[model samples]
Target: MTDTTNTDEQDPAQAEEGAIMRFMRATELDTRLLGMVAALLLIWVGFHFFGYFKNGFAAFLTPRNLWNLSVQTSSIGIMATGMVLVIVTRHIDLSVGSVLGFSAIVMGVLQVNILPEYLGLGHPLIWIIAVIAGILVGALVGSLHGFLIAYGGIPAFIVTLGGLLVWRGMAFLIARGETISPVDSTFALLGGGPYGAIGAVGSWIVGLGACAIIIFLAWRGRANRRLHGFKLRPMWAEYFMTGLACAVAIGATLLVNSYPWPKGIVRRYAAANDITVPEGGLFISHGFAIPVLILLAVGVLMTILMTRTRFGRYVFAIGGNPEAAKLAGINTEWMTVKIFALMGGLAGLSAVVASARLGSATNALGTLDELYVIAAAVIGGTSLSGGIGTIYGAILGALVMQSLQTGMVLIGFDAAMQQVVVGTVLVLAVYLDNKYRGATK
Candidate 1:
């Protein structure tokens, strides 16, 4: 009883300070972000070493190429974003790849024979219906897995693993073990067609406008939070970072647009026996698939859901301490089910986009896609234990994976070797994650 109360209060304050210090010391710079930046730099360096470094290589980094990169990454990127949310809640979905294949088959079957005859729909209507159907089917399948894991109390790994096999078999069954090709032009355009001149201009305008709005909202949110006595990063530092990001966006737009007809290339035979080149009609890069834009929009929406919604908060809390969260009146089980359903819906959308791009449906359409999506998230620094991650981080992770694949091919690496390298990277990432968790504990 010798001033025990005073001793307790003093110890608490000291303990808080110690905890803060420990966190600051333990926190490492985001290696994934650094890795992406490094990978890009290495790509340039490799080009230089290979005697391909020139003004032309700079030209290769055109609006089209940039657009293509965005589009190419979108299908898997969307699935990966959803995976980020699931993993943050300490769950996994191996069925996404199979879900994609199954959804694609569904769409393909509808378009190829069912819808036109049954619904009497035209190409446009059929395309729209097929996409919607694929999404619904995906969601339904995801819910099944969620139910088994949540109310049924099955492990996520087991449920999704079984789902993977089931869905793949369904896809093969739907297509009768044959490939579906020559998809309608309306469907093909979603993946392979350009947005055209007006669409291109519209895209640029919308992109810039969206960037401005994001900057304003972010700044306002930070200021409001600080005014209300909420903990926040330093105001000046936040402002400086925001400004830098804006500057980079503006600079990139100008640089990409400066190239003359980079998106359109034409080769002509001259009367004098010398080949002459002329700029063809303006066109965007093959990477700018419509599905890419769809994926990006979905990513943004999911990010808002995870960071700004109550459900998202519950997800983190449950992952961190389910028992404590349940004690606090959180519906942990329900939330987990909803999240899995959401992930399934995303998987369905990804499959549609990918299939539309390829202009065909096949059982092998989504083969090993899970590996890429999971690798992207892991490399992007999502905690395996859950309760910590970001959409931006996942997207960066996808970029890194895609870049590595694209670069390796450009450098003439064989398919088998590429697989081995990717597999190695994935193992290393898991090992690092385990090490980090051990240290933190």
Candidate 2:
């Protein structure tokens, strides 16, 4: 009789496969992303303990501080997503901060000056109009830079560098170096104060919905692979991934719900609504803020755009090899224009968030923000060499950058020290990314 000892399972390679490798393959998780997440956790915990040792309190990991961090990350996170696309296409936009400042100043002028005159103060349509105008302005500026680069035969670096100065100058000229204040009431909600957050019930609903989507996506991916006769993950692996995603969603919901509105805000709300406060005082949950939701929505849509659209494919193709892409009949110049335009529009939206949060607009509204946005993209694993990046990675990178800054602030680091730390982290991220690429190759 033929020996049927299942020798294939006992091959040397199979025998030597470690548990970690098995798990990685089973889940198809990106090791680099896992490392980034692990690093983020380490940073959080390190800061928490450091604070506890110095100030006798764990300030970095508290729900209140975390919630604020999320809000602070939203604007940069939004812009960083666009920056990924730009970087993926082998380009950079040094003018993003200037564009944001210009956009915010324009929106401020509209809401506080122009629109109010036309639609009357506090008109419901004023904020919407102002936002639309801001986005358009940003897009226009981006398109101009793109035009100069693609058709005008100017290099992207010079064009955008000029734009950085030009847009800021324009913003100053328009606002006359003056600060604009008291934006429309409804528009201010996008900045994410206590009232700007969705309550506990809404947060729970969002979390559960997210879980449902995660499960559905996993199921659909599996089905597609089965239909194509592609290699499939083990059933246990599938379950594990789904459960892990669900757990994260639920955990985030719980964290947001754990943060309560300030006592003063709660008291004011109770008095306004004529509700009696219990002896223990009110504990109104300040669930996910509007800006956070906006960031999430942007992440989802950008992910879809990158992974499920022809434009995204073209972008990667161009980044992989510009000459080949051009030879393949891709309209490289037009694509460049569109990409910059999108980046500009995103910068404008970020401006809306930033100005709204501060309830004002100034020439310096987004000063030095471009550095953080670019750092976030680079840190999130976008290859500076081009053609490799992810929207989710950029967003996570933004969070990481924000966390670092926030932790330093909480630990009493001065502005100069913070910049030093950020610069060092960015260099380290790039170095690690290079090493990772070499190893994978």
Candidate 3:
């Protein structure tokens, strides 16, 4: 009671802060991420209602379509992560589509023709060997391009543009312009299908594990902040974040579990297992595809690489100011080569998923993929001017781009119209990015 009535002036900044701004600050949420999420939700809802009104069925929001959309997004999403680094460093790789096709062709030839001859058909080692070989081929191609740009003084644009044509031509030559089919059964599973999915129980396990990890990470982060004498988020904020992440994990698990295997597949599965079908039809969840898992793994690894490594710091430093970075003792030239090599390796991995998904390899497998990859990165908020990007952003961008195409397809838009719409969106994304940057400045 001695000085209870005494008052202190409120801080000017706090006094001016609005409720939305205060909430954002407390949660430490990324505005860009929130914007993208809102946009995606809008797209999903719009497409779902449109489909319902037009066709008397809500096709877009169905489990079947969403599951298929995730699979389709896998290839482009895989490549889009690497594209973030490339664009963040103020460079471009026009050859990723070509590289994917070329590497996929190499993997196909090895599994279908060469390895089978040496290791015999259905050899356990064939898939592993082919995968490794494809990744190496991609890395080698990327390194060569990086070398030309960093050492030979050729511009990245020129180098990758030349590579685009060269690699496609090389893919055609490798297969003699023919498709390779009936890949190793084990390898085909990597592409994803009923056989390639993890099922309901596995999905639940993964979801719970993810939730656990999220909570642990959040706790550790707070501990580290305290240890380093940095400010800590309020307990409520910490709980909010952890809960949000866990909810997302659980929700995704529910979504994937809700989509049952097709009736034909169920019948075949039951016959193979010697089980009688129930009257209502057997229910088998296609919980999550192997390819989707692969994409998630890549995203986690890339996020770690970018956020918790010296190599990552170097990449951002170079992107922020190449000349200054070099002057500060960073080996910018070699770093460029390494970055490109990583991009190439990812492209190779994407090739594996793409060709495996198709159950065959064709010289035309990755046609125009470059356009999608770049657009995804850009739409996710990677700055072409350099030094700003996030791995998750690119993944979300890839999903958005794929969602647009899928929604259009569901509504019966032809290939030409799809391309036009995608193109317009890309331009709009760029314009928004520029405006956002300007306003922030």
> Which candidate has the top score in lDDT?
2
Q: At residue 23, what lDDT does model 1 achieve?
A: 42
Tens-digit lDDT track of model 2 for 248-319: 999999999999999999999999999999999999999999999999999999999999999999999999
> RMSD, each candidate, Å?
6.2, 3.5, 4.2
Hey, what RMSD does candidate 1 come out at?
Answer: 6.2
Q: Per-residue alpha-carbon lDDT of model 3 for 162-245, expressed as tens digits?
A: 999999999999999999987889989989998888999999999999999999999999999999998788899999999999
lDDT of 3 at 185: 90
Global Cα lDDT for candidate 1: 0.73
| lDDT of every model, 2 decimals | 0.73, 0.94, 0.93
Per residue, candidate 1 scores C-alpha lDDT tens digits across 37-108 of 676567535633443543234322445545555667877788888888789889999999999999988888
Q: On a 0 to 100 scale, what is the lDDT of residue 321 in model 2?
A: 99
Question: Which is the better candidate, 1 or 3, if ranked by lDDT?
Answer: 3
Query: Estimated TM-score per prediction?
Result: 0.81, 0.97, 0.97
